[model samples]
Target chain A: MAQGNFILREKEYLALQASLKKLLANSYAKVVFLVDKNGSLIASAGATGDFDTTSLASLTAGNIAATGGLASLIGEKEFSILFHEGERDNMHISVVANRIILVVIFDRRSSVGLVRLRVRRTATELERILRDIDAGAGKEEEGDFEELTEADIESLLK
Target chain B: MSFINYSSREINCKIVYYGPGLCGKTTNLQYIYRRTNPESRGKMISLTTDTERTLFFDFLPLSLGEVRGFKTRFHLYTVPGQVFYDASRRLILRGVDGVVFSADSQLTRMDANVESLENLQVNLREQGYDSDRIPLVMQYNKRDLPHVASVAELHALLNYRNVPEFEAVATTGVGVFETLKAIIKLILIDLKKGGR
Candidate 1:
């Protein structure tokens, strides 16, 4: 597998959920999400029912990718954090573990300072969990696809 | 790269459409988006300029049913094909699991096709992906045009890997789904090989 590929087992999923939950509580944010740089939603917490998380994940990844490109042109490695303030809501996006994106959506109830402080602590925890997931993926020999056959794959598309 | 979520029994993969300016990469995606069942497709987003040219990229999420009790989802993206958008194109290729090189079949655009194909290889290398190793499908689009190159010529020019190739007219939906299915199958096959 390529270096950025990963499998999220139940153990790491639960840990990620807990950390995101804590961050949402501490910062009084409406929602928090853990998305891969490729725009896959790993986990999310808080009020998520109103928004379409799949689109959010894809757009957030695009935003980060574009920002990373601009940073490179200006002779920087990457812009680690991005904040977008809307009239009624605000978004706090950060890069965690160099491969995952941490997103927090908050309203006037949560200030950027509070969110940033809480995110700093949660980012470290998330990074540790992501590293563990990578390590686990590396230690495994075979994947669930070992039992997958060509017929099975073809049938799905059909 | 693909993401396997055991917790959700889901597999998510990213596939990119690459080609030169005005080569119908976005048209291919639009055809699929319109033909797909509403339940199996999500919102399609296109970041385009005032003249309707792709500014950054276009994104569409799709569900390809389930395999072995695990649902398969594909995120399709089209990069800006203009020459100056190289920076933006490179950004969209990050973590891509498969690619569909949409080559313009017009005889005059042959040089553009070769240049874009070479650019694809270079960008893939920069992203730590070997173009030869990645799951790729060739799409020779605009075949219905008056002045077009032969499929043999297009293949000779762009199909160095001799991968599965399709002749498409994206506007009228000819060969759109065929091209998409070929790439999806290749990606799944690669995944079955432990993503090697």
Candidate 2:
């Protein structure tokens, strides 16, 4: 349950990148990414070369949402951390501030214990940044978008 | 909810196609997936049962060429419409920005259509979204069927709020893009008011 209508700003994204970098450095994970609860990739740090993160982000959100549903059905609040183990690659998905998801994808290079410990520390900083961003979001900024004409929409129809 | 990525110069929106089971919601996504250019569309993923009934959801990410220097991406998802899959449907609508209610046009499925519409409203509320405030469009599908109900009748029954209802035979691609475009238009208009 991310705050409604998430708008990413450059300043906030920079801060997020810094946090994600800290997590990856501390954990030695292959990649660390952040996705809104609704499944949008807010930012990613570390190596994601030649990978399709859009689909990954969408499916990650779906997996977590379904897990949350299953949690509530059994009278639990939420299953905060989801980990998938593979022969070569593993993923750790944790909830941040109940609004965003923090995912750390790694290999045998890092142990689950290390990723978990680093994520716990990183989540706090990321949550603070998200709260600040949400506080400043949704404002009709000056020239936020170039004025769209009916023709712009019509062109899409074509 | 719409996610505007300033860094990527992109705006992403989630649009869900909701309806009773087998009411052409999946077909709508298929047709759009087929018609779109390879560069602009991502792989269409369908999570389904062995019988091909949508078990969880179908996700299709489409890029409508950049508008005003920002790429507009619509992540279209279809909810599992079976009555037994109510919990899955609620999860899919959690942060949806727009909804396209695909109603079955057959007279025999009239009650199912009404029930699904009401179910959608209830699910939206449960997710903390106002059904009235969210951008919504109605598509009376399977109109090519000989025994389908008329648009007027579907309107009287399903389109209580009169949200830009369209008559679509989704299998053949008729009115598919139109329904999609209409909802995106409404979403963009709403985005203009408050979205930065």
Candidate 3:
């Protein structure tokens, strides 16, 4: 099982951003984002400025988790992909590498078929980057937090 | 799980508020949401039933300025405390970095409080976290209510690990930030020691 905590270095972060950008462009989606299963917004591209990406990431994760629970109740591992259709827009949410969630939002400009195809291709690249991240996890430069003090934490609350 | 993104200069941590039903878990987050500055917080999302009980979870995203140049973001969550929502509660604990166990202080809720704490431990273990090792704080909520248990009684019943404990009237926002701050401090200390 993969540990929940991990560090995302600049190298993999840029790679993830590039992959999301390409998926957004190819799928003709309004926005594409990558979120950790824990609901942290890792990276995003496209028309994210118009929406609250934080809430979007969180709700997406929650939706996936709830669906996953249902899947297990029926003796399935998980429902890797979920779709929600709205009158004006649609959301395509899928689990990548069983850890990260890939979300694409689109409207009349795209179809589910196109989004599915684009996500399939991008999911591979995303998984590769995630593996790279896992391989290099915990190897970051140390001592960054060694000097941290309780006073420093107190200052933030102030 | 705590995600440290060096590229974005941000550290994101998930802290969950857990307790039995009507123990003021949601009230704690609501209080923080209302008191927080608009610029430092994101929209608060509550997935509740028609009757307003939490059916899934309540999420609040907060930015606690910065620590050592990296922006610190804490995503707060409250699990549905009703017993039947055990599965939903387990999902919310998937990647939790810390937990604030909100214990209702009413004398009659002692059994409920004990049961909820045990549930929290079992769920945390299933998610690969050791109950004792995880960063946890105890909030004795609804302190102002009539016929409440004394702090000593509540502590003796709920806090076997002897973690930091606070008395809170969550409806009035009293001790809300104190509980939150204590958990955050423990999480940061854990991170410095290499996160679990």
Q: Per-residue CA lDDT of candidate 3, range B108-167, in tens? A: 999999999999999998988888889999999998989999999998998999999999
Ranking of predictions according to DockQ: 1, 3, 2
How do all the candidates rank in terms of lDDT, highest first? 3, 1, 2
Worst 10 residues of 1 chain B by lDDT: B187-196
For residues A46-68, write the lDDT of model 3, one tens digit per residue: 99999999999999999999999
Cα lDDT tens digits for candidate 1, A14-58: 999999999999999999998999998999999899888999999
Task: Report the TM-score of chain B alone for all candidates.
Answer: 0.99, 0.97, 0.99
Error of 3 at B144 (Å): 0.9
Model 3, position B83: C-alpha lDDT score:
95
lDDT of 2 at B145: 92
Candidate 2 lDDT at A51 equals 59
lDDT of 2 by residue, A84-130 (tens): 99999999999999989999999998999999999999999998898
Candidate 2 residue-wise lDDT, B80-109, digit = tens: 999999999999997898999999999999
Can you give the lDDT of residue A47 in candidate 1? Answer: 89
What's the CA error at residue A126 for candidate 2, in Å? Answer: 0.4
Please list the C-alpha lDDT of all candidates, in the order they appear. Answer: 0.92, 0.89, 0.93
Q: List runs of model 3 lying over 4 Å from the truth.
A: A1-4
| Best of the two (1, 3) by DockQ | 1
Q: Is the docking of candidate 1 incorrect, acceptable, medium or high quality?
A: medium
Best by lDDT: 3
